[model samples]
Target: MKRTLSVLIACMIGAAVSAADLGDDGLHKTPWMRDTFKDLREDLEEASGEGKRLVLFIEQRGCIYCKKMHEEVFPQPDMAAFIEENFFVVQLDLHGSTTATDFDGEENEQRALMRKWGILFTPTLVFLPEEVPEAASAIDAAVAVMPGAFSKGTTLDLFTWVDQKRYELDNGEDFQRYHARRIQERNNISQE
Candidate 1:
């Protein structure tokens, strides 16, 4: 009986560890998340140089939704590879004091910058275009903003849509239409 109890406890501990791989800041950490200097302009330039989109991932510590995204959605192989290949992700703490320089030459703490942009969500993703105007802030220059945690399908679809630049298409097939079509296409494919 003692051996069984010990095995159960060990399994529980393993599950907890696998739940969300957290960093010292308490935010969920992923292998694909970039450790940059938090300067949007420089980060954008580096991402451009690497031929990837600049993505600001705003998340707070102890957020269950953020945990879900980190563990359930982001760990999916396809999503991970897609992001690693096409996006340069910069992580920002929602309440952290780390200084982040905006594209407009303004420097502020991560929390203050998020407040200025009216973003109170824990896991907001601000996706940027290839080039941003010098006068615009990072939030102002965002081509797409994902407000919160989403399923792998929705998240992947958003990432794909932004990567493909479907937001700027003139065919009137916006994200909703694109997402619906993707859903239908996935449904039609046999999972043999």
Candidate 2:
């Protein structure tokens, strides 16, 4: 009984340490990221006189990779600075009940929106474009619904491509090629 109790305590301590290592303190920190994201939403609304495009990053509270990203990626000087300057960044907890207002005047809790939008994994990024009645079809087709973790360079390239409206120019081209090209361009620019 004594030996069993000692082993259990050791396991518990190990698990606790691992959990601490994977928590939020390890994730990316763009202090202005949240504000930028909210502003992006407002800017989109102003630009199109409806709602412009904005990006939403959805992450779970206790995810380790989420922490790794918050700590390892966002805080990188280039990423943090670029994100602050160019993007509207908001963090949504996948399991929380925080209220969110859609442009269509619909009110849904965070978790519900996650489900409605078919989000099945953590660290999903969804881009929503300004909504206009006549352009609903265009918005539906052009706005990207992406999910999963993305490295800083890849993430930056995606937004840059979106801003250039490259999607419209690549009617039938493969997505992989488009993304690869964007990545290459970013790499080349960084090298220079």
Candidate 3:
């Protein structure tokens, strides 16, 4: 009886360690992602109400890179908490048949939207400004877009940069510079 109890506890602990779940659609699910009606305008408004930035993640099932992000970087406590606190994330499947309304008031299946946005990869992150042009599609109005898998620091730095609205500044320190400086800052802190 004691051995069975120990085994059960072990399984539970393992589950907690790898918390990202595969949904019925075969896409990874995270607690921080918002399950909305897939309407960009409403999602943006809701995110603004909560004082968070709007981010759209375009991913497809069976995508190894997407799985890597879900199981690796996104599940990290700090990364997860930072995302939950600062961003309203909406996940749109690259091949999904579910209808999603774009910021331009155009409606299409998730797959169609992916093509319309000219996204060719999984794990593409679109960061939007606090306000977008009324007739612009999400891709056109995005302030920054990160494609493919990246290290934890790069991902965090991008999120931070967008959240801080550094893209809107006249300082001309773009994401590359910001990320480079952040890398140096992290290295220095670790060395200290």
Per-residue accuracy of model 2 over 73-99 as CA lDDT, tens digit each: 555555544444455556666775757
Number of backbone-clashing residue pairs for each candidate, in the order shown: 0, 11, 0
Report the poorest 10 consecutive residues by lDDT, candidate 1. 11-20
User: Which of 1 and 3 is ahead in lDDT?
Assistant: 3
Error of 1 at 40 (Å): 0.5
Angstrom error of the Cα, residue 12, model 1: value is 27
Q: What value does the lDDT take at residue 175 in candidate 2?
A: 50
TM-score of 1: 0.88
Q: Which candidate is the best by TM-score?
A: 3
Query: What is each predicted model's overall lDDT from 0 to 1?
Result: 0.86, 0.55, 0.89
lDDT of 1: 0.86
Q: Each model's TM-score?
A: 0.88, 0.65, 0.90
lDDT ranking, best first: 3, 1, 2
| Residue-by-residue lDDT tens digits, candidate 3, 1-192 | 633554455445544545579889888888889999999999999999999999998888899999999988887766776787789999999899999999999999999999999999988999999998899999999999999999889999999899889998889799999999999999999999
Model 1: per-residue lDDT, tens digit, 1-192? 633554455445543333347899989877778998898999999999999999999999888889889888886655676777789999999998989998999899988898888898979999999999999998899989999999998999999899999989999889989999999888889553
Candidate 1, pairs of clashing residues? none
**What global local distance difference test value does model 3 have?**
0.89
